[model samples]
Target chain A: MTTSPQNSADSRLPLVIEKNLDRILDTWISELQVDGGRLLNLIRESELREQASRFLDLLRKAIKVAGVNPEKTAAYDELRDLLDELSRSRSEQGFTPTETATFVFSLKRPLFRELKEAHGDNDTTALLDDIWQATMLLDRLGLNTTEVFINTREAIIQRQQQDLLELSTPVVSLWNGILALPVIGTLDSERTQTVMESLLQKIVATGSDIAIIDITGVPAVDTLVAQHLLKTVTAARLMGAECIISGIRPQIAQTIVHLGVELGNVTTKGTLADAFALALKKKRQKVQDI
Target chain B: MYRIPILRVEEFLLVSIQTDLDDALAVKLQDDLTTAIATHHARGVIIDISGLEIVDSFIGRMLADISTMARIQDCHAIVVGMQPAVAITLVELGLSLSGVQTALHIDQGMRFLRRFLAGRDEEASDERE
Candidate 1:
């Protein structure tokens, strides 16, 4: 490997890439160290440097989308020099071409993003050697983590417009247009909006006098959850229906108070049975008033 | 900080708002909720703000639209869980609900809705006959 290192480096085409790789590694270390890692210490500890490299690559690449200005080039250059020095150390930490290639491959995404933002489609061809390897590895790894990230971001926006879409619950109208909607699962901003809208719409469509929301399936409740619940109850009332909140879990109950969120005088029941009783109590009181 | 909806009820959609309800997400919420309610005929919609640190103008506008739309569908809108900061911001910002009714808690709002439901029932029976 040592005998062919010079030839290998020379033959890799596009002299600038070797320089860039040299720059990226050398700069990343000294500048992006965590817990006060020194350049020399990082070089000595192969595992530590490897870990450091991974973290920096992940964050830098993602953040590169924000735009990598030339002003920060100094930091990258400094770190790359440190790594370059380590690569040439007397202890023989010389990276084979494949290893160097792997390091470059890991950086493919951030590079692509940065290049795209800077020069449009032009950057794609410049890093073909590196990008192709990364792409193949990415395909093989098939990480679905990005999907979750996408869904999460999308869900946030979806909450504002529709509180609810009525995708799961079945709304049935009774003799006096009573509607019972049982909600299960988690609620977020997007889902909260969906619930609010769905409830309001169902109230009008079914003309239901009462809507019971059974929360037996709710896993947890925080400030966001509490807010969504409050919105839902409020919306139900606007539609002219009595809203019943059932199933307050022990942990959730603790969290609500810990967070100091007022349920807005909303009736809370321990179980669905209790919720029905409360709804019935309202009916009885109405009869008495009449 | 993305908040996803797990359950939706009539006029009472349950969603946990999280992360920052940034410009892009706020727009999505407004449009999607508008579509869902328009199709479902939801009268009242509750917006839970437990997971959010703040509510921007975009969120405020979407709420207003949702309330107005609910009215067209014969449903009233009630904004719930307006954090004290949020309330102050909305008031200081000179933003008020024109077509929406708001309550501090869900229970108070529910009582008001019960009456609407009762009144509508009598009217609905009359219409059916």
Candidate 2:
């Protein structure tokens, strides 16, 4: 059974990795520690070694089954999964993209050394061929690690935005029948929808008839923000609750007027105190001085 | 023909919609409610719709029409117990029901109608003076 030079070179790389797994992992980890010193501090030494060995084992198996194109084969799925987990954990631990990817690319030097040792001095062409193949596979895996890291970071940002949206809109019951929703941030359409739904839900739960939307924490009131405020008010009114927008800074009021935004019949107050007082008045309750 | 029941409570006629209303049933409800208000000489009408989970644009229009019809007959209409989701949908559909009054529940609706009517009576007396 005679194998072509290409087949022999492709098949021999995996054999070299399997034979020198320990030596490769030792060199890879040391290379990573030198380039990714900050990343190493974030994770334990033993855990790092285990991850490196597992990755090398999977890579060898993948190469044996799928040759050079491990990415297009089911044999590489376990390798990809391991990379995904490593990238996610490293990203969460504050590893930079370069640092995360170095975990895979750093394996190149150790692997090329082992491939050279296996090929010896007489087969320089086979040695170069093996080195090129190893380079291509490692580069693909390195890029995949960076991509996973970026995606994980983006997912975290999206979840934080959702949490911030929920946190900013809080509907508190001020009196027996008055609810106060202090609008602290900029009101975009999505935030306004959350605000509207939450305020209306609180109205039903508390049976509050009046809601004061205090925008004192809002930095600026643009036309779009005013429109969002109106939508929220309209939604609240539809649910049988009146909205009193308060905390309107003088500048915001000026901006609203200059923008020709029609707040029209939705009540506005200069301060949260004034709005709360008005809400109490509408409910026919007076706060008397002792 | 199915009819949405209208209950008369003192000076107000209470219409609690417990089922999803189609076009014909909605129109029949409008007709029945207007007739009920005139015959009972009710001062206000309270429409409770908490049981309704979905409302299309047609039903929104019908609600506005019902309030307008009640107003023509010298009666005030307060829509009560609207679900939060329905209210959001209505506003999103650009049907804020501005002409129609709304309350969180039936009891609040009754209180609003009483206060509203009392205010109107005082204004009428003031005008007479």
Candidate 3:
């Protein structure tokens, strides 16, 4: 190991990448294929190679412009964008965070091999210094890739959750003048708004005289949920459609009573059928059970 | 000056709000509706707001005021055809329009008024007996 100027290793890092760009890319792709796992099947071979090539080119350019460390600077903005797109696609394509991070970390081996082969006999100390800088840079980039991957996954989950919330709260017309809204799942403020909007819309469209809100599918009844229900009932009343809350399970009944919640003139029923029957009765319509 | 036209349908007064309501227009609507109720001898009033996409607090308050004024004149005020978005906005704005009675559409509103008036007629006959 021979001592040399510190800046020589940092400066030569980008030069080594620039000189052996094609070879580094080729080696990087092969290395990625070996440990790339299920991500290989998700993305096509040509697309993968193109992505790897672009990343290397961007990496080389960013290093030239931003020096050895390229984190958090305008010089690496394009590189960060590329990584963001790559991680987003990976997330959509079902790649795990570890797998996404591995895509970046896998390039380190080929880069280190190229650096060693290029300057192996020149000076061991400078060669190791170059490898060290490469390791730090790749580690930081790899960590960021994982973060972006996780963020994409979380965003996908949140959107799916919203869709599910919408799907579960549907208002259906049970009769000519009556609407039935069966609420399934926990009642959050956002979901309550959806319920109110849909129920009120159906009432207006159908000119429904009575609305039955069935809470059988709801998991739990808390103060917030009760408040949301009250708000819905009140809104429907204001619209001139009498709202009857039904599907109160034994547990929910106990919960409501235990909480000392005052429903104040709002009618409650033990089952949706009971509420529907009441609605029919209010309309002066009756069904004879055979 | 814009005035929301109030039309008379038989014994009921019909006002279809097809445009947005400003403070002046809404105030005019309140006065015009009550005057029309007396002019037309309308026993029922149906205000159709299906065309309105937004209902701020002021509009909601105007609706409540109309219901109150109609009630004082011995007329049933049935606010009908309120858009779902409007209802949500009204509730979110903490304005329940408690004095106003709502129906899904004109047909329901008419039927509601018919039932109410019929019930009133029965009570009046019973009082005379």
Q: Highest TM-score among the candidates is held by which one?
A: 2
Tell me which residue pairs clash in candidate 3. Answer: A239-B102, A240-B102
lDDT by residue for model 2 over A68-128, one digit each (tens)? 7765689899999999999999899888999999999889888898988898898887788
lDDT of 3 at B99: 65
Question: Which portions of model 3 miss their true places by more than 4 Å?
Answer: A1-15, A25-54, A57-82, A92-95, A116-140, A288-290
Task: Kindly report the docking quality category of candidate 3.
Answer: medium
Residue lDDT tens for model 3, A1-290:
45543464444788889999999999888888899988778888899999999998998888887776765788899998999999988888887888999999999999998888878695787788888888988998999898898889889899998899779988899998899999998899999888888888788777787999999999999999998999999888876789999999999899999999888889999999999989999988998979
Candidate 2: segments with Cα more than 4 A from true spot: A1-10, B1-3, B38-42, B117-129
Docking class of 2: high
Give the alpha carbon lDDT tens digit for every residue of A127-238 in model 1: 4533443354333222222332344445555764334445544454433544566666687766665556666666655545567777777788888788767766654543
True contacts kept of each: 0.00, 0.96, 0.79
Best by lDDT: 2
State every prediction's TM-score relative to the real structure. Answer: 0.32, 0.89, 0.82
Q: Supply candidate 1's per-residue lDDT for A108.
A: 45
DockQ for candidate 3, C-alpha atoms? 0.56
Model 2 accuracy (lDDT, Cα):
0.89
Q: Single out the weakest 10-residue window by summed lDDT for candidate 2 chain A.
A: A1-10
lDDT of 3 at A143: 90
Output the chain A TM-score of model 2: 0.90
lDDT (10s digit) by residue, model 1, range B1-129 = 453452467555544465567777776666676666667766556665535557667777776776776677666656654554454345335565445676445565566566777888899999999
